[model samples]
Target: MVYTLEVPNTYGYVVLGAGVGSVICNIVLGGPVMKARKQLDVPLPNLYATPGVHKNADEFNRIQRSHQNYMEMLDSYIAMTLLGGLQHPIACAVGTVFYYIGAILYQKGYIDKSLDVDLARYKKGGALKWIGFFTSMYSTCALAYTMITAK
Candidate 1:
């Protein structure tokens, strides 16, 4: 006799898991990675010397701390969703795909200086910037929501 594996209706759990995962990963791994990249490009001391440097630094540190909290929160959230069990592999896989795609776009030139306002206005009212902006936003939201809601 031939046997086949059965799949469970875990879409809701998957979505929530992925959503929580994305948020946690983005906060923990993604934020530091992006900050490191920014440090390479602009350097931290230079960042410290900017007009609102103190305020900015405070905000940045707050965000970093928040990411750490988010990571811990994810553990609890996942456990709650999974009920002390592992998440479905398919949901994890799909979440990973979305996470990487967003990461790549963000790491590329999508959020660079050329896309900033003065240049955007100079180059005819920011069509490309807006497109990129919307794309990033949509991708991020979809990925987060899908991860959170997947069962």
Candidate 2:
């Protein structure tokens, strides 16, 4: 006997959420990375880091930091969606939306050069930055539990 997983129609909302999130991430990351590549004269592939001191190293760091901040949370969001999405699409959708919102918060702070102020200033908006993390984490945990104990 083969067991098949059921993907509910509601799951589409989660997909939508993921789509929105991806676009936000790509758009947010693109500007800095692209500008950094050009400003550093390092080509697109080498945008990850500034390599050595360039005239625009400080500016490049802003772009690089925003990209890094987005990626830092991306994996966890993807994992939670994949692991718990089928079991709880509504939760996943909500989680995904907030996760994207959280990323947006981080990106806004990064591009504004807010992080440069200091660690305390960087975390000034504590609730906003962490809501996504908490929402996804809780929903994913709940979904995982449901999956394991299903009758």
Candidate 3:
């Protein structure tokens, strides 16, 4: 009824990488949003541009929202990846990849000006987003269960 407390070195590294990668992705995504805000003349402290009031407001809003959406999920993703990596590194790693890929695709689709459907383009990456989120959730739960049951 004993358990080893050590996490595999590779697993630890993978977890660290996932966390760092998420931050880096967020930072990179933000650059475009910042540039769009400046170029489109979106002022600071305004969460969003007024529809039809600001020139190209929709475009700038979309760009900003894409980055904001990623930020919204970043904290949870990092936490799940770290906790889950303790028990299931491979699963967490895969989940991280899925999430990032999905996030990027979602961002691209959301920011595309050609799409006239407003937020509908997010559907393009919605499936992967769910899959990745669930995967991480499962792994994190497994880690919790293991810790509680361990002797």
Candidate 4:
């Protein structure tokens, strides 16, 4: 029996695996978790408000639109990750670049006022919160590993 030594292609494999895992996990658990969070009867703080009067119906609708846009951004990001993982090395490179850009933006307070009050209610130190945190952490780690291992 001869064992041939092939250098482990860690980067390619990790990216592909993480991408597939993210798509599956999000599709399976994301909707249900979001729905449950919506059911929580908590009032979210208003991040945006004009000086005098509170937000009118139209303003509230605008805020909802922003949230929808954010969700769409997330969907595209995950899709990109999966596509990169399954495609050429360029995809992995793109994924790595996007990750770093997001990290930098996050560090610079680009996302500070983006949290919704109702969504925060679900993160009140319970099983759901832990699960959410762990899932995010795992995904982050997977992406980081893939980026680091890519040649």
Candidate 5:
């Protein structure tokens, strides 16, 4: 008997999902940190930013919140992936793409949060929030089903 390493073809989507998702996540997190440094006028490393920094800056807080939410979602995605147990190649891959798209939208929408006078332009109608949430749910279901049915 010989054992060969062969990943299911459908897993390609899963791989792409992780790769692109990571890049998008980094952007979400990194952009805010940079903006925070500039806004707070904190020197290198002193960006040890506390919420107090946003006392008068609404936009800064929005950016900070977006980063925090991304971290939380990342944890959820990891758990779902683990529960999915590397099975259901097709479902896993498809779910991953949708998940990434949802996260991107979610981050964009949250970052856009503002109290600017031009409220109309700044307002995001919760599109990203719902998209990210539903997709995250769908992926969870897909993973659970696959794990439950696996032999």
Candidate 6:
């Protein structure tokens, strides 16, 4: 007998939510970058403001790096959330929620003038990030393992 994989019908909603959330996250994080770009006169093709040459360079760099850093891992987050949701919707969804919460906090901590001095402020979000990432990763691995061993 072969074990067949079955995904819940409602999981589709979870996937769609994740997609919408991703777009929202992108916009939320990127908005400041665009504002900083115009304010700082960071022209196209030059991704970041020069540390010494540009006024308010430190702040601009923080904003840019926060957005850039999030984007760097977004694809993985989406993949894990969606794929893992196929078999473990609740876990994936919960993980995604935590991840986004962490992301927002992480961005806030990085850019907050009062908190910027302590780079460790970002660690608070980082912990939540790992919780989410690992949950999805575990789900994905579980799904893969189930599929592979199914006969």
Candidate number of the best lDDT: 6
At residue 43, candidate 2 shows an lDDT of 63
lDDT of 6 by residue, 1-151 (tens): 7777688886875586588887888888888889888998887777888977788888888888878877899888788878888899988888887887777777777888767446743654655777888888998898889888887
What candidate 1 gets wrong by more than 4 Å, as runs, is: 1-7, 11-29, 36-56, 84-151
- What's model 1's overall lDDT? 0.41
TM-score of each: 0.31, 0.72, 0.83, 0.29, 0.59, 0.86
lDDT assessment of candidate 5: 0.55
Candidate 5: residue 127 Cα off by (Å): 4.2
The model with the greatest TM-score is 6
Candidates' lDDT values, in order?
A: 0.41, 0.65, 0.78, 0.39, 0.55, 0.80
Stretches > 4 Å off in candidate 6? 1-3, 116-126
Candidate scoring better on lDDT of 4 and 5: 5
Q: Tens digits of per-residue lDDT for model 4 on 21-49?
A: 44553343334324323443213453333
lDDT of 5 by residue, 45-102 (tens): 5424445664535555555555665566676665564334245555655556555555
lDDT of 2: 0.65
Backbone collision tally, model 4: 1
lDDT of 2 at 49: 49
lDDT of 3 at 132: 76
What root-mean-square deviation over C-alphas does model 2 reach? Answer: 3.5
Q: To one decimal, what is the Cα RMSD in angstroms of model 5 from the true structure?
A: 5.5
lDDT of 4 at 22: 46
TM match of model 2 to true structure:
0.72
Clashes of each: 14, 0, 0, 1, 0, 1
TM-score of 1: 0.31
